[model samples]
Target: MSAMTSAAPPAGARRGYPLIAAAPPLIAAVVTAAVSAAVWSRLPDRVATHVGGTGEPDGFAHPAVLVTVSVLLLAGWGAGGAWLAGTARVPARALYCGALAPAVLLGYLSPALLLANAAADQAADVRFPMWHLAVAAGAALAAAALALVLPTRPAPEGERGDGAAPRTSTLGLRPGERVVWQRTVHSWLLTALQGAMVIAAVLIAAVGGDTGAWIVLLGGAVILALTTRVRVSAGEFGLALRPALLGVPRLGVPLDRIAAAEVRPTSPLKDLGGWGYRITAGRRGFAVRSGDGLWLELTDGKQYVVVVDDARTAAALLNDLIARRSAHSEG
Candidate 1:
C-alpha cells in the first residue's frame, strides 16, 4: 500500500490565512450600497445598465434592480472563488486575485452608473464616458495588486492512502493482441443547465430583448457542444477525450508522451473546482462528474485526469501498451 502526504510549504511562503474569501465581495457590496444611497436623491428612476459601442445607453433598468443584480453577481462569483480556493487543487493566489479583480471592476461600474445617471431626467440622456472604462480597468488592476501583497496560505495537498489502491499492474496480453476501451461520461447537471439557458434565451427573445437573448443562446450552444458529455477512449492513439455530441474538438495524449497511467478516485468539485474542462497548477483534464478517473502522468511531469467509470481496464491496457512500445523501441 502507498501513502500520500502534503509536502510542507516552501520557507517564507507560509503565512496566516485571512478571511480573504468574504472580504472583496463584502467590501464591494458595502461600497456599492453607500454610493447608491448617497446618489439616490439626484438619480433618475431608471439607470443605464447596458451601453453600446459608442457609449450610448441602449438598455435600462430601475436603479434598485441594477444595484441588486450587481450585488448578487459579485457575491456569487466571490463565493465560487472561495469554494474553489478551499477545495480545488489550485493556487490560492490565483483564486483570490481572480475573484477580487471582477468584484472590484463591478464595484466601480455599479457606482459609476449611478453617478453618470445622477441629475439626468431620462436614462437615454445618460452618456457613459469612455474615461469610466479606464477607471474600472485601473481599479481591477489595483485589486489584483492588492491580492499579490496579501498573505495567502497554500492549498492543502490531497491525501491518497485512504482509498483502495489503483490498478497499477499491466494487463496480460498475447503477442500482437489489440484492444480498445471506450466509455461515455455524462453530466446531468450540465444537460439541465443547457436546457434552462436555451429556454431562458427563448423567453428573453419572446419578451423583445435582442442582445441578451442572443448572448444567452450562444452561451447555451457553446456549453452543450463542449460539456454535456465526453467520450473517453484508450487504444492505439492512447487516451482521448472528445465531446460526445461533436467529436471534432478532441483532447488527446499520445502513448509516447505518457510515462504512466492508473485508475484513481476523483471529485469534480473538490478536485477540479466544478465541472467541464479544468486546468490547475500542474494538471488539466475533463471533469464531468466525480467517480473513478484515469490518471495519466505525462513525460513532461504534468498530470492529466478524466472522470470515467471502469477506469481500471483503461489503466491496465495503457500500461500494457506502454510496455510493448518500450520493448519494440529496445528491440
Candidate 2:
C-alpha cells in the first residue's frame, strides 16, 4: 500500500485515541490502587523506601507517601504515554505496548513493595531478600511480552498484496503504485546464547528454590523467542521492523520524514554499538548482526539503519517513495 494512504487521522479525530489507548495504563492504575488498599493495614507505618546495592533497605518512608508517589508517577506516565500514542507515526499497538509495559511493572512493584516492608521491624534496618529484585525484573519482562502479544485492531484492510503484479522503480512511483520488499533475518548465535542463559537460570532456580529466578528465565525465553527472528519490510510507508511472532511493526520510519535511503554495509558493533534496537551518539538502528541493510537519513538530520538481506531493493523502493512524496508536496 502507498505510504500516504495510511496517513494519520486529523487532530480532532485523534482526541479520543488517547483515551482508548490509555486503557491499559488506566487499568494498571486501578489494579495498583486495589492492591495497595488490600495491603494497607498490613504495611508498616514506615516502609522501606530505598534499597542499597547489597539489597538491604537503606531508607524508609511512610506507607501513605509511597502510595501517593506511585499514583502520581503512574498518572504522569499515563499522560505522557497518551500523548505519544496520539502523536507518533508508528502503529498504535507499539505505542500501547510501550506504555502498558511500564504500567504493568509499576502495578507489580507497588504491591510487592508494600508486602516486603510489612514484616519489617520498626527498630531495625529492613533487609529485603535479594530474590525480590530478580522477581521484579522478571515481572517487567513478562509484562512486556504480554503487551507485545496483546491483540489490537487487525492490519487495515487492503494492506496485504493486491491482485496487481509488482513493479520496479528507481526514480519515483505514480500515485497508487506500490512496491514492497520483505526479508526475515535470524541469529543463531544470539538464540544459542539466550538458550544457555535460560538453562542456567532454570537450574539455579531449581537448586535454590527461587520462584523469582524461574520467572526471570521464563521472561528471558519469551524475549529471546520474540527477537531471534525479525521480518523487515519496506513499501510506500518507508521501512518497518517487526518480530515474526507478533507480526506487528514495532519500529517504523514514515516516508514523509525520509530524506534519503540506501543499501550499505553496516557493523553492528562499530556503527550501532552492537545488536538489536541500538541508539548510538547520532544514529538509531534495529540491527541483528553486521551486514548489508537499508540506511535512512531523515529530514530531521537523524539516521536510522536496519540490518537485513535484500536491502538494495528495499532502499531503492524507499528512496523512490520519498522522491514521490517530495514531488507531490512541491506540486
Candidate 3:
C-alpha cells in the first residue's frame, strides 16, 4: 500500500447520464408514455389510420405497453449502474465506471424511444432527433473515458522521508538496480476490454437495427463481468482489487480511510447519478451491496478505493497496510 500523500492520484471526472443512474419511478414511466404519445401524434394520417385506433388511440390500446417497456428499460439502466458500482474494489475504481458505462451512455439516449421510433419510422413522417442521440452517447463515452484513465503521480516520499526505498546492500545488484513494478498485463487487458466495448457499440450503431440499444446491452454485460472480483489476499484492514474493463487498476481503499459507509437501495433514477464512486447530493457513498466490501471515505482523502467482494480480506489488508506505514515512520 502506498502512503496517503499530497501526491495522491487524481479523481476521475464526475459526469454521466442521469437517466441511467437512478431512474425515478413514476417519472420514467410517465416520460416514456409521453414520448410514445408524442411520437404517435407525429405520424401522417395514413400511418395513424393503419395502426387501427378507435375514435382516439392513446399510443397503444392504453399506456400500459409504454409503461412496461419503460420499466424494463429503466431496469436495464439500474442494472448497468449497479454492475459498475459493484466493481469498486480498492485501486479499481475505474473498473467500476467501466462496468456501469453502458447504462450511463444509454441513459439519456432514450433507448426505448429510439427503438420505438425506428420501428415506427414507416408509419410516421417525423423522426427522433439524431442530435439528442449523439449528444447522449457522447456524454456517456466521455464519462467512461474519465473513469478508466489511470491516475499517475510521482511516488510520494516513503514514511522514512525519501521518495525511494532505503538502500539495501543485499539485492546483489550494483548500487543502481532499479525495480519498476509497473502492472503491464493488467493494464493492457483492461484497455483492450474498453476497445472491445467501443467496437461493440459501433457495430450496434451501424447495424441500423431498432435503435442502437443492442450495443448498450452488450456493453452492460461486459461491464458486469468486469465487476465480479475475488480476494487476492487475506489476513488485516483491507486490500483487494475489483477488476474493470479499462486501463485502470482495482479499487483498494483502506478501511481506515472510510470515515463512514452506508448502503441505500436506491431507485435506478432516484439516486446515484451516472456511475463510478458517486457522492450523492446528500454525501452518501453507494455501492451496489454491502455483500461486496466498499471503503467510502479516506481518513486523509488521498488513498484509493474499491468495491470489493471480500470484506474480511479488505479489512485485514488495510490493517497490514497501516502497520507497514506506522513501522516505516517509527523506524
TM-score per prediction, in order, is 0.51, 0.45, 0.31
lDDT of 1 by residue, 1-331 (tens): 1222213222112132224665687678778888888988887866788888788999986676566556655655655555444334456676568878988898888888888888577899998977888899998999899878877554335434345465465667556999888888885545654664565555545545557645867686677857668899998689988878788678879989998998766766665666778889888888765566688999999988887777777888888899888899999
Tell me the number of clashing residue pairs for each predicted model: 0, 0, 39
What is the total number of backbone clashes in candidate 3?
A: 39
| Tens-place lDDT digits, model 3, residues 1-331 | 3311122111221223222233432244345556656665543322221122222222321222333345455554454443343322222434435444555554554544434443554434324545655676787777677666745333223212112221111112222222211121122223444554555455445534334455575666567456532223322334334343442464444445544332211221223443334555533332332222223335655323233333323333334445455556699
Overall local distance difference test of candidate 3: 0.38
lDDT, model 1? 0.71
Off by over 4 Å in 2: 1-176, 201-210
Residue pairs in candidate 2 whose N, alpha carbon or C atoms collide under 3 angstroms: none
Choose the strongest candidate by TM-score: 1
lDDT by candidate, in order shown: 0.71, 0.66, 0.38
True-vs-predicted CA distance for residue 316, candidate 1, Å: 1.0
Q: Please list the residue runs of candidate 3 whose C-alpha ends up more than 4 Å from where it truly belongs after superposition.
A: 1-243, 249-275, 280-286, 290-292, 301-306
- What CA root-mean-square deviation does each model show from the true structure? 8.6, 16.8, 16.7
